[model samples]
Target: MTEEIQSKKNQHPADGQQRVVIVGGGLAGLSAATALLGRGVSVDLIESRRQCGGRAASFEDSEDGSLVDACQHVAMGCCTNFLDLCEQTGLGRFLRRDRTLWFIGPDGSRSACTPATWVPAPLHLVPLLFGMNHFSFLEKAALAWGMVRLAVRQKMSDGDTELTAAQWLHSRQPERVIQLFWQPVIESALGESIDLVGISAVRKVVVDGFLAHPKAADLLVPTEPLGEIFGEKLVAWLRGQGVAVHSGRAVTGIQYDESGKATGVVCGQDLVVADAVVLAVPWRAAKRLVPKLLPPVDESFVGSPITAVHLWFDQKIFDLPHAVLVGRVSQWIFQGEEENSVSSEKSCRAPAKEVEHHCQVVISASRGICDGDRNELLETVVNELQEIFPKARGARLMRSRIVTDPTAVLSVRPGIESVRPHATTPVENLFLAGDWTQTGWPSTMEGAVRSGRQAATQLLKMTDMKAECVVKDLHKNAFIRLLVGQ
Candidate 1:
């Protein structure tokens, strides 16, 4: 899918102006733009879509007039980059959630997990160990034991061990626990089956979610529409800062200088010159742009499909936030309160009437989920919901839309440890930034934000931007701690 030209307005740079061209207006690109703008550098952001926000986007249903997210996406309570963006852009208030994750199991069983306390940092691990969702009491104990072992070990040392997540779980966890809990969670996170996902990657997720905090694992789903939250705000902010954001502008090729530096970018018969370029698109997109500039990305990098089944019901059938359904056609279900509230309140308040507000039920982390067998999938989900929520049995189906993206995320396979691209590429002045890149975390919002921040920080070295508040604090804290201790 090549994008057509959306904008050609090129403003001439004033005297002593530093320019940066960012391709792909995803979280990474927008974050980079914000950071660069803060540093007094001019940026030009080109997005392939007419709208901003790459994957973290939202669409509206014309028939029902309800807002629908691209996927049932959320963040962790401990996402540093997301928090930083919120603070920087004054979008913190929108990052609202009840911090409750309800996991529904094979037999219509439901478990709710919430943050136990606010002790800050290290003490956050308590609630998870004692939490009731997803893991069994014994499995939680085993995970705790594994965390202790993982924490004590060295950092930046968990490399390619030719081990699978399933193998790691099998070795460290009981067979029953692996089948019942870890399999679903791992499959969702890594975008691959547990038997294929690398052990180290799984360990990283375990450390971040399980070991980080008692509430760190709490689901932080966005309340507002996704594009409204980050994407649109970013574009408006950039334009306010005199930055050019070109939606539907796609780069077809990159021209290199004699020294192997990025000189210009070609997009639909347009040759845009730039002092620096950031390829913030996905791996496959990057492959199309410049295959020789980076490492040989595995076809496995395209990964598997993640289908989100959005089913609208006449009456509200579920009240739980979201649930994990084991031993069924779906693994996760995200209740769409936003969509439900969009419809008439009278409809929402009514019981199992044929006339009611719309409700969206999301089936997430759907690996082999396809659109061919729509009836089969819907029947399975409806039956399951009937078992869990008795009112769902008679609720009329208003709309059932099945959305699937094959390139949802990079497959973190067992030997895929080497496929992730680094920040710097062979082409100087051209860098890469995406969750799929080596950001330590899984292909998550946190990882995406981290990658963006790192890329911005690196690019800042070429500019004369003042150190950020966080950087200044780091310096101050290091000096103060050294003086006090020494």
Candidate 2:
């Protein structure tokens, strides 16, 4: 549903000026708008929500009067395009990069995974793998063999896309290794199980994220709520660049000429005309809005769920900023308020005392628990935390909130990559941008930004506006080149 606001008369470009109307105010739409505006093009970005960021947004919680993110979104060093957009939006400084990943066993045994600094690409993780006490020596050897095979293998052929990651990995690695090492990473990254994810998608994650470079696997988390990062800061930056920002306005339908060129979009009763249009909405929304250009709804492109359990304690429970829980319903636990302590900000609406110790537990591909009782989920999460962190055993639970997103991201199912369309469609004037598009990446922020940049580049070319919008991927390090012979 679109949040209605006072209709500002639709602004049309003057003579010789190119105007573009971008539907959807998510990262894709925002990225396209920024790129087009940088090229001296007029942009009118339309969003249905009161704030920008779409699925990666945050809102003020009425229960505890705190601003909580809908779901935790993290980025890796391999995400060059998304990092570039963060730099452009002045959000680079608010990001915190942690190289070491902490893993907590069910019995509360802690293990840290940190790449070897002196070691080169691919081998940089060897030290950590051998040093990790959670897995047996034989398990480590098997896992190493699997990784070697993944790094040395060629790109997925048409036949390979038909196989699931689980099927391929199970054939190569043991079940213990699959459950301990591969399953968590695959589910967290693709928002689906290995049995459901395509082999190509899993290969991309491993090659680009882990084996590409030493720093490629580093995780970057936002210090503030997503609304502050993408909503307030991004909108402010866009306004400073002379682009028209229209929040709380939804584009009901696209306005096309008889010649089959998209002129603009219909926002409520207002007809905002433009020289070009970029439909950056989700797959379902895009199908409903412009079915002529996009194909019919395909169940194959359906999305998966992500659930977050936020808990506030009277005192600090965990010392680490974040930790991955092994053999638990909760996959990752993030210390929300301790890192930067921005909870006192006016936008958060949180009482100073209420946010003393805020923690968030994230469960990706959480279809099993999405419909479960909220109180039961909270209790289960608390029990898991107490088991993992001894400090949490006696901590008083001040407040708790559970946020479940049924369609957090498109499922990376086998054979789904072929169905994903490119930025440039058959229609000349209509462009598409979203994480679901064929960006050669999964449904992450990086993929969304890449799709937007690709859309902007194609739109510029179609309009005869010469400009480069797409950013190149990170170059492979020398070690990878020597090992893989790329």
Candidate 3:
């Protein structure tokens, strides 16, 4: 490893070149590297893991030797920064966009939520919500009233950050609306229960995702595994731009000068110096590495857990690519890649008889079953699937694999947002980039990318270089602009 570092040092640009060292090769680090490289700045990205993508990553299935994601990560049309990064990295073509949302109720009733093209911004989902069977007419009316209140409050900047989402909605919405509509969306978006998530985060989700534009709520799922999207394709593009990509290199500590300015990073025994450094790691990792540079993060601002149950069946069970299971243990279900096709660079080729239908059931904010028996959880998911899809009742389970991340996403509690740091830290020439940063967004891929862009832009500004590399948000419609006072 020392020899390899020395070789990279030999290939480093001349002393005058403006080089950056980015620690953590996740979406945030990759985004920073891409932005810097685009501006002819040299970058060295170091990742502790063998592969990148951080939370949005995949691993080999020991049973079938197929690649499976740690958890299913989806994107909404409002995620402009994430989509921009995908397009820049040549991954835009691999995304599968679905405008309609399929909702399956507990008793096997189905409803579809499709936006109306003829309708204007805030009303685009009105027809679909009215037509849905999941909620009663009274419940829909209550939900509409709550949405209007939220929009008005957001426009007026009158939200109470001290309140939880559940507390905010308790008096306005009925129990049915809370369970049938609010909880699922809250869990899916914030990865926390309504009572645990902040009202500000909920407002961001409802406003930016649903009311901002007609297409903002459209969901995009990757047809390929996440490793291929963020690992192979992204790393290749970065390398093509003369960025030094180093994997399995853990940055032990950050180096600073007597003036309290970042100089470089320390990887084990070797120190790789740079003009600037971006610490794009998780909050816990950042606290451990640079405790003095960052503000004290609250101990209560921990992470929420997510669990993915991957199962192979004897035959196809789900007709749709993905669906949300209403009031079920499994929040979302994704139809895995079909047989005879490669899902990733490392996916295994299977024989004809070995080919089977694959499906993944994801449970977000899954604290209830994180420590439960694996077999019991698998059986519960299977039973829930059988309840929803009649075809799944007779399908034999070929194999099962469960993936859990205890610290999947940062818990967006009511007061936790105040603790999230900004892109620019106290240390000069040092920046922070992560999903946990203050990006005016929650902990999503979009937030991660936005933080990266923000950090890179700040670094460039400090160095007196071009700083407008980050993409802007999607334009709001005329009516929405008027409503939100944009």
Question: Which candidate should be chosen as best, given TM-score against the real structure?
Answer: 3
TM-score quality measure for candidate 3: 0.94
Predictions in order: lDDT:
0.67, 0.82, 0.83
Q: Sort by TM-score, best first: what order?
A: 3, 2, 1
**Candidate 2 lDDT by residue in tens digits, 335-432:** 87553233444345545544457788999989979898888889899998888777899899978778888989999887787788889887798899
- After the best TM-score superposition of candidate 2, give how far the Cα of residue 456 lies from its true spot, in angstroms: 0.5
* 2 against 3, candidate with superior lDDT: 3
Q: Which stretches of model 1 miss by more than 4 angstroms?
A: 1-12, 118-129, 133-140, 146-160, 338-340, 344-365, 464-486
The worst-scoring run of ten residues by lDDT in candidate 3 lies at 339-348
Candidate 1 or 3, higher lDDT? 3
lDDT assessment of candidate 1: 0.67
Q: Distance from true position, residue 15, model 1, in Å?
A: 3.1
Clashing pairs in 1: 104-324, 124-213, 124-214
Model 2, TM vs. native: 0.93
**lDDT ranking from best to worst?**
3, 2, 1
Best by lDDT: 3
RMSD of each: 5.1, 2.9, 2.5
Runs in model 3 deviating more than 4 A are 2-4, 10-12, 154-161, 298-300, 339-352
> Distance from true position, residue 283, model 1, in Å?
1.2
